[model samples]
Target: MLRFKELVLTMQEFFYFALRAFATLPKAKRYWRDVLDQAFICGVESIPIVLVSSISIGALMSMEVGNLLEEFGAKTMLGRSTSNAVLRELGPLLMGLMLSARYGARNGAELGAMQISEQIDALRAFGTDPIAKLVMPRLLAALIMFVPLIALSDFAGLQTGALVAQYYHKLDPGIFWNSIYPRLLPMDFVVSFLKAPVFAIIITLVSSFNGFSARGGTAGVGRSTIKGIVASSGLVLVANFYVSKLVFDIMH
Candidate 1:
């Protein structure tokens, strides 16, 4: 019962924190430079890991799915199968998890440190809205940047998958490309792109909230950072599934 109450209170506080962050969206102009900086950090710094994970997953999926399709004498469907997996599912899903670890961890650790050093308090004492100065910019940056990251991840994954299909599966590049383009649906694109902002929200808010709630000095910073990463990563996975399901249900 005590644990349940604490959970409820935590939820309440988080609701207020997120509300305040969103409420400060109008002040974004005042913090445009911070928004741009955060965008570079989360968007530009995030590309390599996103590419690495998506390319590896795409290659593996193509190889495995190609083999299985070969057994059924349906190997020509490799492009279509791999396309659905990569673009509609794995591509965005993997990007979200990667950003949750990389971007989310960075936000958590940096903000946690600021919280511990009383920098956030100092901002408050100066009559500045800390959420506007700190959290809002991160939120806006993630919101703007995650969409392109997802698009890049989808493109890289499909390209790698095509290469794998042609080389390892002994399939022709023309056939693979042909199969994918004709079968591609607007719904697939919808499902893929929509996950970006959803993931951005989960990662930014959860990490920043954990950071602001940090305590116990240096050790606490580490703890909060880890908690932010873990929580955001888990939420990313959950949001991935639900967003796909919801989109498919409503659109299909």
Candidate 2:
């Protein structure tokens, strides 16, 4: 009950801050440079890691699913299974987890450090709304970047699966490619990218909340960073289930 209460209160605070951030968008144009900088950091700098992780996931899926299907003389289904898994599950989930660990912790620590060092207070002294200047850019960047990143991850996973099927599984690339499209529907693509925004929201809100709530000093920043990652990742996984369920229902 205590934890649930804390969760509710934190969510309330998040929504409040989010609304203020959104309302301040007219002034956001002045911070366009900051938003772009954040987008580069969160999206561009993240590509290599996302690509590598996605490729590994794809390769693993091909290997495991190929072996399972081969036992039943159904090796041709490898591409279908791997593609579906990547599109429906691994793509968004892995990207969210990666971003939560990388960006979430960094965002929290940066803000927490600012808070502890009185920089946030100084911003207020200058009549700047920290939510607008600080949180809004990060929020906007996360919202904008997650969809493309997930798409890239999905593409990487599918490519790797195809490669693994051709070289490792001794399956024909044409067979793999042909099976992928027939097994996929437009809704699968929609659902894949849809999960990303929710995960992005989780990361932004949880990280910023922890950052804003940081107390003590440098040590507090460290703690907030860890807490932010944990909370954001947990929420991403929980939200994934519900979002996936809703998508499933819609598709049906």
Candidate 3:
């Protein structure tokens, strides 16, 4: 169809634009301000959301694990199951999804808007590395912040869940903690924590690329923003499955 051809062409152009953005970074200290903005602003602002989501995740997973194990008279193993799952997969994936939906889309839209407004072009006129200035810092910040957030989420979620399962669910806290905590080997946390950085790369890179590549006017920017979020979020889910499996396989 003619429409399909146009779609393909659009994507092809987008890649070229991304490459241009990549070329924007210069070899200097000028980019640090942008990186700091990403780290302290974008990355820091995302924390409260991450914490709240993590707590909910912990409580919910506890219920699921507790209910399932309780039926098997393995209620004490609730902590183990919950901990392993969070440390290995859920934590990074959830945080990435949240970031993509919240921050990723926002970044894309901001850049896209700038592009439409000709601000990016203005910077290019002045010989700036938009990629280094804009994209790289976001990517760096994401890589920096995401891993810690994942670990925090996993630990907090599991603990919160365990507590809920203990009193609210009439479960034995001592048994649950003892049985489950021991199973969360270093590898479990390491595997999930590792994925966060990879996701960070994916998120900032994809989003910033999408934003900078946005063409036309307001509609194009809006489209790019939505697509970036949706595509990045989907990538996170798919990536989680493959990466988690690969890590566990290697660990085991």
RMSD of every candidate to native, in Å, equals: 0.6, 1.5, 2.5
* TM-score of structure candidate 1: 0.99
lDDT string for model 2 (1-252, tens) is 999999899789878877886787677688999899999989999998899889999999999999999999999888888988999999889999999998998899999999999999999999999998988898889999999999999999999999989999899999999888877898788889889879987898789889999998888999999999998999989888888899889888
The digit string of per-residue lDDT tens for model 1 on 1-252 reads 999999999999999999999999999999999999999999999999999999999999999999999999999999999999999989999999999899999899999999999999999999999999999999999999999999999899989999999889889999999999988899999999999889999999999999999999999999999999999999988988999999999997
lDDT score, candidate 2, position 93 = 92
By TM-score rank, best first, the candidates go 1, 2, 3
Candidate ranking under lDDT, highest first, comes to: 1, 2, 3
The residue ranges of model 2 lying beyond 4 angstroms of the native Cα positions read 1-8
Model 3 segments more than 4 A misplaced = 1-28
TM-score of each: 0.99, 0.95, 0.89
Give model 2's TM-score versus the native structure.
0.95
Best by TM-score: 1
